[model samples]
Target: MADINEPVDVLIIGGGASGAAVAWSLAETKMRIVCLEQGDWIKNEDFPSTGRDWEARQFGDFAISPNRRKLAADYPINEDDSPIKVANFNGVGGGTILYAGHFPRFHPSDFRVKTLDGVADDWPIDYATLEPFFELNDKMTGVAALEGDPAYPPKPAVMPPLPLGRSGEVIGEAMNKLGWHWWPSDAAINTQEYEGRAPCINLGHCGSGCAQGAKATTDGTYWPEAIRARVEVRHRCRVRRIETNEDDMATGAFYVDPDGVERFQPAEIVIVACNGIGTPRLLLNSASERFPDGLCNSSGMLGKNLMFHPYSQVRGHVDEKLEGYMGPRIGTWSMQFYETDPERDFKRGYCYQFSRGYGPVATAVNGMADGIIPWGAGHHDAFGRMFDHSLGMLAICEDLPEEINRVTIDPDLCDSDGIPAPKITYRLSENSKRMLEHSVARGKEILQAAGARDITSKTIFPAAGWHLMGTARMGTDPKTSVVNEWGRSHDVRNLFIVDGSVFVTSGGVNPTSTIQAIALYVADQIKNRIYELFD
Candidate 1:
């Protein structure tokens, strides 16, 4: 608990990518800033370098509480119809700490729906508006990958592209035979020593924190500058609510410290960057007499438009061992069919992340379950045989906003503090369904073209990758949005939501880059607007 003599200029919740970026952006503004994270800070060294072996803390640091209501998503709500694996990490940097570090920009078609095919909301801003900031974020984050990518936008590569492995190259050449556009996947990693971090060593086990500090997890990038700028980072602190005045202007936030001590920290402005799923739930839980239906849910849309990128996968086992698991978690992407084409019964596109590399523990368990023997002589032989040859390519589908998709407080559930937990209710939209069907077929085609002997495919889960977005969407129309294009809450003057919740539409590309761009844009707006308000 911070003893603030003066109200912090901004109080940010969740120390992940969005929160970290905003905190760094606000640095040196002479404004007091503080970020509260639910999980303790774990460094790159603490992250698992190899298999599940020697990773007790990484696998065991479950945020799941003794109580049922405030449950973190460790257990999948249902067994069947799961997307790959349910993933959730609560710490500074969120999934960015655990992400594959691929950094492909959303295509120009991503921002405009009516102009492209007429479905989703036109981004209040477009690629042109965001391109410069995207470049800035790529450079600041020490991203690896050369530009000249014809499938996407035009920009000088922030850094050189990562070298793809034999598996990736084989797949790339096959996909090219089909006349589809493909490129060396751009990544938020160092390919050749940028800043203080080393280049990626091609060890594919990136989902668990990079031991070499080559990946651009916030801990390796934004956090360093944030510390240099003198920003305060409070870990193991879970915020309960935003305390506001009669005018609905946020004055502070209430939080529980690591030792279960309750405290309040004052703030001139409260920025909620707890990602898409967590952000809305926080708002819905911030119940007060003034806000009976969540803090900024006057339109009754706090947790609406919930989305999970309905993803699918294509597995491959070439005749020759590709040694896929020995490379970085990811190395490249393919967006040949990204634009929405109604002629194909879909209104959006999908991206292919060709690196689905896994380590020994994941491989042994999953392979054995998939019918490779797990015990005795057969098990040992099968495990060793499949270890070096397994490779997979995943299809990341774009989901459109539907009224039925949502996140709400579970009336029956509560956290450690007796507060209700977030109950996510979601189903694939028709557009998402169409997108998935198309992606699955195309992914299978790519696998066969690459001469894969045995291939398998998987879909994206709402919980996996934690790329959830659009629950607290932004738009120009007040009738359908919670915030302005700049991410200022439509109803609350001094309260703003800066996470993935503000997206009117979610793209196939990862949201971290967009979130960073929005944070930078909002920081600028706050600076200019405050000056205008005072003058």
Candidate 2:
């Protein structure tokens, strides 16, 4: 037991979305479980927004991109070949640390993309199989939502909805006039203090890390419960490879500790919860004589079919002051165009989210980028023209899984731990482009209907890579996918994956809720079939 290669019943890698959820789900069991995270625990005081210079810090140190953050725990991602930038955090909470807590579930149509739309491949499991897990996770994480949305099957009780500020009212009214479906957002943010956490104070900078603990990050929610249940969490341990036995069965993981010493943790079952890119990176790097291609790449689909939501935003400047700087950044949303229509050239549809404009400093900086604010005396007036009066709508466009879009290891680039960085090679498909174009046009119309004069729209939103999906997709056939419906590796039964990488289709919504649901569902399957998992 004193050996570094101490054996355990289960070992989970990456303490992010699915990692934390799986740990929490399996905590009540008698099995010994341990999770390894590359980043350290985030301190409440480390949130920049709590300080006076937070706005400046937001652009500098607190930027969402891993390359920009450049923290000790961060692993560099080569995004030169990708149109959409990869933005994620390397901490116990993972990307949830900077996410806006937008927790939208994948639509039912999302699972049947290949059958219904003849575009992307369909998921092995349907929404019905995962619906119970979705509700269970919502109860655990405390979602802020409203009832009576025609889009969903009766949603279980969520916390009282977050306040829809003037911006949401404007967008809601516009959607009503246009005969579109709009609903208060399904967010992980607390409104009436659920569990032990406090309610959101309307701080307006949720993307910069919520200092008030109102936003439900994994570190703030699942990790605490998991730790209490005796799940050992080791921080600052970077996993280098997944080791396999002579029969090509997964034994455990080899990782590098913070003290620059190599360590091994043997386990009966090894689960990979590293997001789309990181999962592929670890697998591709763990090559052996038995599986020279990769541990689970016998199908040659390990790092293929990378999908990201192609997103864009339309910002409108209203005549009346809307105080756009206040309230949650993303609250109300419209899903009228969620289902694909034959009239539209796109295969799948997109969702529209009403967003509050940035702070005064961010607004001024944005104006400078667009040349709205010049160098001289014109700066102040141009900045004030859109300071507190601007409200925007973001269109989350569905991206199909294309074989060409993938995650590969960068041979030349290595991280701080001497591990090869993951290289993303992604581009929006023609279908995606058409979907984004149509969504932007509709967004401009909604902004105009809301009594806005100056409106600006773009094809690509700068910071929109928060939701990563695909790469190691789930399917029925071992030849076509990396994992089965239960998230078990088709080649190596002892290995499992419970992250966005198992997503077959890129749903036109935020993936945090769906990611957690998948994890919970997979964990339940493991619990039921513990003895037969590797059979």
Candidate 3:
């Protein structure tokens, strides 16, 4: 057993985007804060610079999937031949360090889904309650967007949008002719300068690691401010379990330090921000005599109702003469059908998009020309044809919540640490199936409108489930949800979660914005009532 470390006022597990945001939000308080991260701090020099080299960092020597064979659905089942992406950081910032950097907020209807659309469960709190937090998060994260972009709602972006190249312009013009709503995208990347970070240099490898320091990775944007305000981030520490007393208040947690020392870190408050996959696993693993079914699981919904934003995109070849890999990753989106229109069979809607960034390997993968076959000599010729002229369009569809789709620790699969890993069993609902079909159909229409001679679209989603969410969802009802509106676990008063895991619904938009907003809101909750929670 590890020795017991001196108890702090608060102990946080997983220093990713969720944990880091919470720490930054609470930095001004007078509490001794210590964050335990399982991954080490990696600098820009530590990452691969080339597109093909993405395989190294995306699936590095340290990357480990809970599933011995496959991680949930983000990637394919056989990863040996594919790019290694057991990828998620355990460091100061987590996956934000290597994300595509898109920052789209959830529509207002995303919050009260059950009430409005009569579909999945409603969030414990409504969109109005989270609106301020979203705005606060946008400014805090230094998002680049336009104030009056007709595409999305009219909110003032913190920074100017990085311009789209000829690719987006041509498509945007064509979209206009077809009466589609399109505009420059909102991104966590810097357009010029804000709060000490420089503007983006257009390196185009935002997914691997932004060496120019323009992309707003959590470590780059939040951790520095947090540390300066006295938040202590303990790197390479793996939290094993969270302990609570009979009163249902969290006491502390156990972990293994990088030095191989076993230690118990006690705290009055505990926040679990270990992303979607890690959070539920920790809660289920933290079983005790007091709460054998898992902490905060009185409703038996802690590890159930899993949600994954399974994405499917249409890859096409535009015949126009333009530069593809010349600018930032994911520059713009079309919001023509982002709202609930009965014309669309699904209760929710998907965002159609046109983005103009390319990595060498990513560009090579989908660069087949119009008249070319996809294999052998023909593949090489087609690959060369669209190498520079190619741009991509994708649609992010919403996956409705389902109780049967779950992430449970695979009894047979254990990592080197002897800890049981997560085994995800998921099947889409009829609603999501129709949504994918509709989104793909719209994508094909847009491609044809853009005058692409040929279109290669994928309406089927196989492994894009990396955006796992709602497994340990927050709600007003204890019987149906795991966390409260404030993100507190219903069964354990001292335990709180602030990540995608606590989401009640998977919004069509990328989750980073709401994830950070929730992190800030939960951090304030911890700060205002430390005494009530601890004593």
If the candidates were sorted by their lDDT against the true structure, best first, what order would they fall in? Answer: 2, 3, 1
TM agreement with the true structure for every prediction = 0.92, 0.98, 0.92
Alpha-carbon deviation at 298 in model 3, angstroms: 0.9
Candidate 1 TM-score versus the reference = 0.92
Q: Write the per-residue lDDT of candidate 2 for residues 1-68, one digit (tens) a residue.
A: 11276799999999998999999999988689999999989886789778988788877667888898
Evaluate model 3: give its TM-score.
0.92
Q: What are the lDDT figures for the candidates, one per model?
A: 0.73, 0.89, 0.75
lDDT tens string, model 1, 96-144? 8777787777778878876677777888888887777677788789877
Clashing pairs in 3: 2-262, 39-90, 73-463, 73-465
lDDT measured at residue 415 in model 1 versus the true structure, 0 to 100? 59
Q: lDDT (0-100) at residue 167 of candidate 1? A: 74
On the 0 to 100 scale, the lDDT of residue 193 in model 1 is 86
> Tens digits of per-residue lDDT for model 3 on 406-456?
767766655445556666667767887788888788777777777775566
Please state the error at residue 35 of candidate 1 in Å.
1.4
In model 2, residue pairs whose N, Cα or C atoms come closer than 3 Å (at least 3 residues apart or on different chains), thus clashing, are none
